[model samples]
Target: MGADGTPTVMVVDDHPIWRDAVARDLAEDGFNVVATADGVASARRRAAVVHPDVVLMDMRLPDGDGAQATAEVLAVSPSSKILVLSASDERDDVLEAVKAGATGYLVKSASKQELDDAVRATAEGRAVFTPGLAGLVLGEYRRIAKGPDATSAPSLTERETEILRYVAKGLTAKQIAARLSLSHRTVENHVQATFRKLQVANRVELARYAIEHGLDE
Candidate 1:
């Protein structure tokens, strides 16, 4: 934890240079910081040891993706929040990361000041996105508001829609499975189906859609 009672953070990225630099910046900004340069193994270890309040996890790693690794982290410490730090603007990748348990997302090339502020925002329990991407996240909300026919929305079954409501609430596949008395695989399938039907790319968008349409309630 920080001196101000702010939560500590763990920075995970495969790039040693950027990882160290980001860690140093966060430290200067008064965060208790732990950092790693490996994707799968190191990220897990760091999370286990630090149980950080916020995590700045890279989306891509040599051995695994940050999204894939987030589940492991959550299992160890369910209270920890994850924020993706990625270079890709690929829509599907963003959605998958969010669906996988990340609380927020950020793109690389963000200035030092921007990244610093983002870390603070996330630590304070707020969602953050880059400029253009915020619009994309907002669009999903609009799709729901304008109705299923307003956009290229696809039709979903009752079960799938139920799963989407959980997604909007930031529940993982396993959690949803347990809540609905379905298997993990079944929940994953429902998520994929929702992705296809909505003509949307990722969980983040789906979540916004659910919230926008009042599916979360």
Candidate 2:
């Protein structure tokens, strides 16, 4: 969230028209368009100053790919959540962006409403992905989990495990709170604790851990 409570966003894309158009759309949708950047360098530089609540990132930039831009921006503004708005839904690209610390992934073909919802969810610390891409990401994580590192998984409290199951099933913090008869903040706290314990950066990774451990059911 921004200083004024509106979610602040930064648009990073190489094309001026697309960049400006996204910025305009977000502004019209009630988000504070704090800054716009054309590539990795500008994104990093501007993020350090604005520290936006969300960043709408384009995969192809003049200087580098969105994965690099995502990593750089988060390095400067760790609290900023990145939502990749790209044309390609290729498996490697999605996985790379997620590995680079992006909080969500949305194809450029998504409806404006979907983009709006995704940005809002990203700001609120939810992992958003274009429908099928999420399964692909989860599959990758599942395969990786079969490796030797899977044996050292961390343990969680019963309440934390219950919340993790909800997270893996794509329930938002608010929804989980309602289902568990707990406060929203309490749900978020448990989610954060799960994140810390699992050594995962975001909900996507946490969900992966849950699925790998058969907790998604």
Candidate 3:
């Protein structure tokens, strides 16, 4: 948490000027500006340390895509919320970020007030998207929801199910490992394998899987 009890945030855009501007605005809004990263590697490294409550990232970084970095960050800080803040509002970009476990998506054109509010909403676990993008994401999810039932879904090991319950409860991988008496790497491995088996792109979908299967109970 931040000094004012607001959530801590990380800005992960390659452009220093835009990144700094966002960071400054967030800081001014009483959010704890934890750290800023220019690329995927640095984002992962800083995120591991700060374990920020929310991450604001651009879709295209100098080294990689924001969606990929979102997955990597969640792999390390499972409880962190990622919010894609990019210039592009294309449907593909929005869906990709959501599939990558982003809690929200906002374009760079958003006003500082809008960005601040979105950050707060994301920290509280709300799925935020730039005006029209939210409808598209929801429609995609609804389409996917009709494709499979949890019962007929691919099978998972007992351990995967156990870890997934904690995931659904919003526990970080580190926290889940501590509770289950498992190594960090072991838990992460299970999560990755589960991702492959379920064909879910990221943690958000993983949570949905748990809910659909009643594992979240």
Candidate 4:
């Protein structure tokens, strides 16, 4: 969230028109458009300054690809949630962005409403993705879980584990709270605790950990 309470956003696209349009839409939709960047270097520089709540990233940039930009930006602004807004939905691209710490992936074909909702969700720590892209990400994690290097992870409490399962299933804190008859704040606390215990930054990584450990089942 921004200092003014609305989610702060940074638009990173090589295309000037598209970048401005996205910034305008987000601004009109109640987001604080803190900054705009055209390439990886600018994205990292601006992100370091604004530390926005969400970054609307483009897959292709003047200097590098979205994966590179995502990584660089997060390296500077670790708390900023990245939401890829790419025209390509290729499996490799999606996977690269996710591995680079993108919290969500939305294609260019998404409606304005969809984009608005996705940005809001991303700011709130939810992992939003284009419909099929989510399954692709989760399946990749499951495959990685079979690897020998996936053995050790930090331990989580039983309650935290239960909450993690719901998170892996893509449930929001409010929804998980309703399911468990707990307060939303309580659910968020458990999620935060899980994040700390796993040393993961966001819900996307937490979900990946859960799937890797076969907790999503």
Candidate 5:
């Protein structure tokens, strides 16, 4: 963590100017800018040492692909959350990164404030997406769930189901709690239970499942 008890972060991008600017902005916002790397190898090497709370990764690196780097970094430090910062908004790229265990995806066109907030959200285990990509991902999940070989769906309580819908809509636990007239801790508990029932790791996967089953409607 940083001096102010803020989370630690690493910026990994092939472009020097962009990397430096992001690092500077995050550092100014009270994050501990632990390390900066320009490619996959360096990112993996440095990440093992620092184990930052959040890693801002570019999808295209000079030495290797960013999704592969995200997997490698997580292999070395499973607690670290990776947020893909890429120029591409292609559906395949986003899905590939998500499959590789990225906590979020953001495009290069995102504003500085958006990027900064995404890092913070990633560290807190929330799923972030660039604008319209969340719906694309949800649509893919829906298609898969509707396939002939789809298995029987997991059972969720009515409360859990409602919360899942809120999650699919990208509402945070606190926000959901506020809207539902429940305590934040109660909402978090429901979320964790929902995750276990669905066997998903984070909000993104849970949201995908909910959307796939038409619970988000």
Candidate 6:
């Protein structure tokens, strides 16, 4: 636990072997780890008990989708981070997970070192995605926004949108400030403004939101 909380991690995947393996990996990294090979409800119950710093789950489970589990976890523990884990990097899975509040996404192909870094980043409220996963998430958001039931995006100011474009290009706040001839504090404030308006936590979410709404243009 850093100042925020203990790095307790909950694993929710149906495969017993995989679940145990992930739990072992996290434990080896000194994380307080809990794992369940059950459904979403069981995972939620375990999460409530452990109140983990992060939850790593498979997108598909026996009883329900990990998206619902993510919502439940965030509802119960708003500060907790969620990371989707599975073999599916499908656009729909990626978007659904992000929209449901997951801060990270990883496929089974990830090495132990990569998985460790991803979880650590997520626990710090950062977003992580494998190669090409970011674009997949953005595409799904585009599809959602184009659907009939789509809601209007939060209104953004010119500065906020400009800041968002830089974010979409993967520039850090300091880097963005340098490029835009603004103070670092000013750039950070703009980033925070975007976060609040989009109701997301980190740069990856902000970038995905920006790209989805055509703010990059």
Over the stretch 46-126, how does candidate 2's per-residue lDDT look in tens digits? 999999999999888889898889989999999999988877635466556776777667888888898898888788887
Candidate 6: tens digits of C-alpha lDDT, residues 1-217: 4444648788888888878888997888887785554668888777776677888978888888887788887777777888888665354555556667776578878899988977887777665644334444344444444655346444457776676566656676567789889996686566444434434422234333322344343
For candidate 4, the per-residue lDDT at 67 reads 79
Model 1 Cα lDDT, one tens digit per residue, 82-128: 88887655555665566666766777877888888778767765555
Model 3: residues with Cα > 4 Å off, grouped in runs: 142-217
Tell me how many clashing residue pairs each candidate has.
1, 0, 0, 0, 0, 0
lDDT by residue (tens digit), candidate 3, 101-146: 7766778888888898888877876645432343433334334445
TM-score of each: 0.62, 0.70, 0.65, 0.69, 0.71, 0.68
- Which whole-number lDDT from 0 to 100 does residue 125 have in model 5? 75
Query: What are the lDDT scores of the predictions, listed in order?
Result: 0.66, 0.74, 0.71, 0.74, 0.71, 0.66
The model with the greater TM-score, 3 or 4, is 4
Q: Model 3, 32: alpha-carbon shift in Å? A: 1.0
Select the stronger candidate by TM-score from 3 and 6.
6
- Each candidate: RMSD: 11.7, 5.3, 11.1, 5.5, 5.2, 5.9
lDDT tens readout by residue for model 4, 1-217:
8667899999999999989998999898889999999999999999999999999999988798997899899999999999898765355665667767777688888899989988987898876644344444444544544555455434566787676667667777678899999997787666545434333323234333222334446
> What residue pairs are clashing in model 2?
none
Q: Is candidate 2 or candidate 3 better by lDDT?
A: 2
| Off by more than 4 A, model 6 | 2-6, 35-37, 140-151, 155-217
In model 3, what lDDT does residue 30 have?
86
Q: After superposition, how far is residue 98 of candidate 3 from its true place, in Å?
A: 0.4
Instruction: Give the candidates in order of TM-score, highest first.
Output: 5, 2, 4, 6, 3, 1
* Per-residue alpha-carbon lDDT of candidate 5 for residues 144-190, written as tens digits (9 for 90 to 100): 45655345434457787676567667777678889999997687566
